[model samples]
Structures are given as structure tokens and as C-alpha cells.
Target: MDVGLLLLSAAVLIGAVVLTATSGDRRIARLDRRLARVEQKLDAIAAGVGVELPEPELGHVKALLAEGKKIQAVRAYREATGADLKEAAQAIDQLGT
Candidate 1:
């Protein structure tokens, strides 16, 4: 009975270690993807073809949308960030969801 209990405890410990290692690996992979995306954006900026506009506060946009001011929200976003009509519309659409 004592030997059985010891084997069970060892198995549980090994399982926990494997679970932790896999989770850590997943987290590292996610971070690496995010970092790569950021690097690509920076490269675009360095190439002088990137339209780096100031991002609007999402909270304010959400408030405007919640107040049922879709047009106003799009206009505010465009005016504040110098984004084109299509870009502003897309941004507002994303926020709406």
C-alpha cells in the first residue's frame, strides 16, 4: 500500500511539471508572435510609408457608440486621428462589436 501511494504521488508530480512547462511554452510563443508584429510595424515606419496616426481612446469611442451616436463617433475618430473615412468607419465598426 505504501509503495502504491508513492508511485501515485510521483505520477501527480510529473503531470504537474509537464502541464506547467507546456503552459509556459505557449505563453512564450504568444509573446514572440506579438513581438514580431510590433517589429513589422516598426519596419514599415522606418520605410516611411506607414500612416502612424494617434490612436483614439477606446473608452471614449465606446461611450459615443453606447449613446447611439454612430455617425458622430466616426466623425470624431476621423477628426481626432486624421484617418480616412473608410479607416474611421472600420475602426468604429470594430469598436461596436
Candidate 2:
């Protein structure tokens, strides 16, 4: 999960490609499979770290808050997000008047 580790992995993969381009060893001749594996790894990393989930709808929660019903707003947030009491309260608190 470290940025340095990710950069090192990319650098190593690039170095391998460059080495394959210049070297003549028969055993290390091709990079197609290796590149595919690197692509898969990069895809997995992106899925885990870069993907963004959409926020839950909060129109009803906002309406409740506008009506000065804080408790009902927290309950709406909980139902919308499936968050527990504390989490919903904290989230609704962040959306201050």
C-alpha cells in the first residue's frame, strides 16, 4: 500500500522490458506473459485502491435536517447508508446547518 513500493514495482517491470530488449539469453527472450501478469497485478491494485464508490442518496435526510429534526435525519442517514447509530450521527453532524 506504500507509494514507494508501487513505484518500485513499476520501475522493476520497466527494467525487465529494457533488459529483454538488449539481452540475448534464450530463457529470458519474451515478455508477453510477464507483461500480462503485470497488467493483471496493476488492475487488481487499481480495483482495490483507486475505485470510487457512489455516495448514498441523502435528499430525505437533508429535508429532515432542514425541518430541524436532527434525530430523524440521523435515522434517515442510517437507513440510506446502513451505518450504525454513532456513524450516522457523526456523518449527519458533518452536514451542519
Candidate 3:
């Protein structure tokens, strides 16, 4: 009886751990999908113009958008670099990296 009970408890614990791991995997998959979509949009925007943007540009864009200071960032980068709006935006992003 004791052995049987112990086996049952172990099985339950293993099942719980498996479920937790699978749930984490599912969450990671969802996040990856979301990131992919965002990257697709960014690529579309960046490639529509001449200069291709780097990773830092995307990070700066994300940060400025989050802070609701995208316009300020654009202006600052433009003044500092003499780049167009799009290029300045990319420059600000470069600063992030």
C-alpha cells in the first residue's frame, strides 16, 4: 500500500511538471509569433526606403514609441546627424544599441 501511494504521488508530480513545461513552451511560441509579426512590419517599413535599418534602430523606435517621445527623438537625431526623418529615426535606433 505504501509503495502504491508513493508511485501515485510521483506520477502526479511528474504530470504537473510536464504540464508546466508545456505551458511555458506554448507561451514562448506565442511570443515568438508576435515578435515575428512585428519584425515583418518593421522590415516592410525599413525596406520601403533606401537605407536598411539595423537592430538598434528598431530598439530605439520601440523605446521612443513606448515613451511617447518619437517626434522628439526624430528631431534630435536629425539635428545631430543631418539625416532625413526616416534616417534619423534609424540613427536614434542605432544609439540605442
Candidate 4:
């Protein structure tokens, strides 16, 4: 009986973990979609203003920062936007503020 109860408890715990992880993934996906929409709107606005804006890599960098990955975010920003180290660092700093 004890063994059976232990197995059931483990199964419940596993189910909870899986549910939490999937929920988080879904939330991230939803946020990504929303960010894309916002980027499109920003691009349209920039076009209307006849101003050239930097690429949308900043949004991804900001998301990485929100996830507490400062170094990785900086690297990604540099890679995506082809900015030098100093520029990437400054961009990340601005986003953090």
C-alpha cells in the first residue's frame, strides 16, 4: 500500500511539473507573437515618419534580458544586429534601464 501511494504521489508531482513547464512555453510563444505584431506596427510607424530605425533585434535582446540572461542577450544582439561589442553593451544597458 505504501509503495502504491508513493507511486501515485510521484505521478502527481510529475504531472504538475509538466503542466507548469508547458504553460510557461505557451506563454513565451504568445509573447513572441505579440512582439512580432508590435515590431510590424513600429516598422509601419517608422515608415510613415520617413525615419530609418534599427533592426528589430532589440526586442529579442530585451526579452533575453527579462529572462535574466544578460551576457547571452548581449551576444545575441551583437550577432543579430552586427553591432560592435561596445554598441551591443550600450544597447543592452539602455534596454535594462
Off by over 4 Å in 1: 49-97
- Tens digits of per-residue lDDT, candidate 1, 27-84, equal 9999999988998889788679756655556676677889999999998888877778
Listed per model in order, the count of residue pairs whose N, CA or C atoms clash below 3 Å is 0, 0, 2, 0
**Candidate 2 C-alpha lDDT tens digits along 19-94:** 9867856545457568769978987987889875588999999989989999999999999998889999998889
Q: Write out the backbone clash pairs for model 3.
A: 56-93, 57-93
Candidate maximizing lDDT: 4
Clashing pairs in 2: none
Query: TM-score for all predictions?
Result: 0.48, 0.47, 0.48, 0.58
lDDT tens readout by residue for model 3, 1-97? 9999999999999999999999999999999999889989988887888657443334444466568786887875565455688877776666556
lDDT of 2 at 17: 94
Best by TM-score: 4
* Candidate 2 residue spans exceeding 4 A from truth: 1-46, 49-51
- State the local distance difference test value for candidate 3: 0.75
By TM-score, is 2 or 3 better?
A: 3
Which one wins by TM-score: 1 or 4?
4
